[model samples]
Target: MKKNVLLILLFFCLTDAFAQIDIKRTTKDNDLKLSALPYYNYGKGLGITSPDSIFQFNIRFRIQNRATYMQEEGEEAAIDGQVRRLRLRFDGYVGDPRFIYAIQLSFAPGDVGEIKEGENLNIIRDAVIFYRPNKHWNIGFGQTKLPGNRQRVNSSGGLQLTDRTINNAKFNIDRDFGFQVHNQNEHPDKFSYNFRTAITTGEGRNSTDKPDNGLAYTGKVELYPFGSFTKDGAFFEGDLKRETTPKLMVSGAYQYNNKARRTGGQLGDDLFEKKDMKTTFLDAMMKYNGWAAMAAYMKRSAHDPITFNPNDATDIKYIFTGSGFDYQLSYLFPSNYEIIGRFSTQKVNRDIAALAPDTKEYSIGVTKYVWEHAFKAQMEFTLDDMTYLDNTSKQNWYIRFQVEMGI
Candidate 1:
């Protein structure tokens, strides 16, 4: 089944690429250049260049197909597979390079709304516009990924392994509708720095409106001692780009959501009622030669950890206040293959530790980068252990394989 899905996805990608029409036509006031290119800065897509540099657009899409096998302490091994992601993206600029816009649509079943009996494509991943006044400042508006954590912001297609750490699923702020400001200061002789801040509706992505009465405020700062990364490679795993010099970046972020409706901050389902929440993040990335390493820590808190309703026997679930950490290391070989290892641990508060088990996970994987991250095959084995407050323990092992095609 996985193979069939992969074959079908590949066929569609190829058909789309071959169906490209090359045209270089000029109008009275505008000249247009459109080409069907296999791989460029934006993957497999149509590239357009407008006359007089007034307007430009690129259309591209990608798909991720995966299969997995897992076994828990006393259960039979389970096998499962599905299409993980199917995304189509559009990006362009108008008049000046400073004015840029992007929109991404998701067709995957998991990414869209829950269908009663069938599937519905609830698209729209990123619909944002950016205005850069100068080299140091940029302003943006709309829905997009928040500057929450390194792993969360990194594109899934660019991961070194088959999947991200479990900590990200529980702690990272996925996306939201907001206004953002970015500032970067570069000094060839001194260390460079970058800063970001945002104000957004407390609700997560695709939320039509803010029913909660409060908003979310987020801020982040980063420092690079050995200058900056090549094409923002710090966000990606592995040393596939192979930096010549040793580069390092350290960052810290904080977010506060007043009257947040979701139990998992901005990523999970709505809670019984709103609660004020706060989260902190710290991360570091370093790469030298063919070796790369990353470490991150996350902690969450709420003003009211737990609440109850006197009217009914049921009460709002307690905020899963906790902490999580992840560490990753990888080495890239000249043959375009990478070996990676990851360790992650999560701990819940004492109040809910009995109900919510503490978790520890270890993963090792290898990736063959066909063309960087645009086209790759990856496989990994993971060992997950959970410890309950009663001292009981459960273990699970997972083996997974995935193919990523971004064109």
Candidate 2:
């Protein structure tokens, strides 16, 4: 049974790592004079402090193991391996530090998705809560990710490929249940900005039953032009801090989803009517010295993007209205070894192009990072190229390997 639920989740993660090493050795051998927490580092994980410092915790976990092979053009050649992401995270601050919080969980059955018929195993990817009222705003509420695209808000353990693309798996809006507002600013060496917005529950992420009266609005903007890239590094993906002056970021986003009932609005399936979705995104990123680049563009729309089934007329369901593009580049070698490249394309919407097709892809990757994306290893290759609606075309190939680790 999934190896006894992975040995009871590895015996509660080794009994919480031996009860956090006996509470940090009994608070330093009984000196008990609290206020010292913050020791175990290595990518900043394992910390817990609450002796009146008003609650703070941080525990992290990550895993990703993957393998794959494929080939097609008349099929037959496939291979696979799994556990592609096992996550477990928690971050904290509660009575103050501007009240932050976060939680994440997923135990890999492809990170807990695909169990429907009234849902139940989506495994909560992030729970969110934040306020951060200073140094440039931030306000958030439950469930995360949906500033949409920049590789779907980056961080699939920081990528540089072994995943993501196919125009972010076909038009990425990927998470919901929100309320967010954010802002950022800078002018230090000149130029930086960010803005974000959200309002959600367009059904996704534990969406407890409200099948209609849709919501999901979103907005985003960002600009950087020459500032910001060192620590935030344009939100991770091969550059590993090598920016010695020359950085950039640009972003744009929009979403609507009023009346959306899925088919990829907040993520696929569950639609036999309701449509009104709209999406758009644009992106850019750059870095220097050790090079990096990115590009994106996406589009979605629905006015009558097909969804019929009033007692089935062959059971209809379309709404992957489409448009996509992606591009990437990478470099990184100062021994942290990286090399990546990507390209993607998409185009559905000839009224769903007879249920989707028209693709193009290409990828190549290599990574090693070892500790830069909290430990990594990757390999990728892809080719794809499809086209259909009876115009016929095909091609495929893939290969992958992965490994990732986190604090």
Question: Every model's Cα RMSD, please?
Answer: 11.0, 22.6
Which candidate leads in TM-score? Answer: 1
What would the per-residue lDDT of candidate 2 be over residues 278-326, giving only the tens digit for each residue? Answer: 8899998888889998888998888888878898688887777878888
Query: What is the C-alpha local distance difference test score of each model?
Result: 0.85, 0.83
lDDT of 1: 0.85
Instruction: Assess every candidate by TM-score.
Output: 0.86, 0.34
Instruction: Write candidate 1's Cα lDDT for 1-407 as tens digits.
Output: 99999999999998887677665676875866455433234335776765446777899888999999999999999998988899999988888889999899998886775754442235778999999989999899999989988998899988888778878877888788889999988654358999999999978877654475699999999999988887778778888778888889899999999888777766665577789989999999998889999999998887657656556656656677889999999999999889999999999877667568899999999999998888999999999999999899999998999999987
Candidate 1: Cα lDDT at 289: 85
TM-score of 2: 0.34
Counting only residues 3 or more apart in sequence or on different chains, how many pairs clash (N, Cα, C under 3 Å) in candidate 1? 1
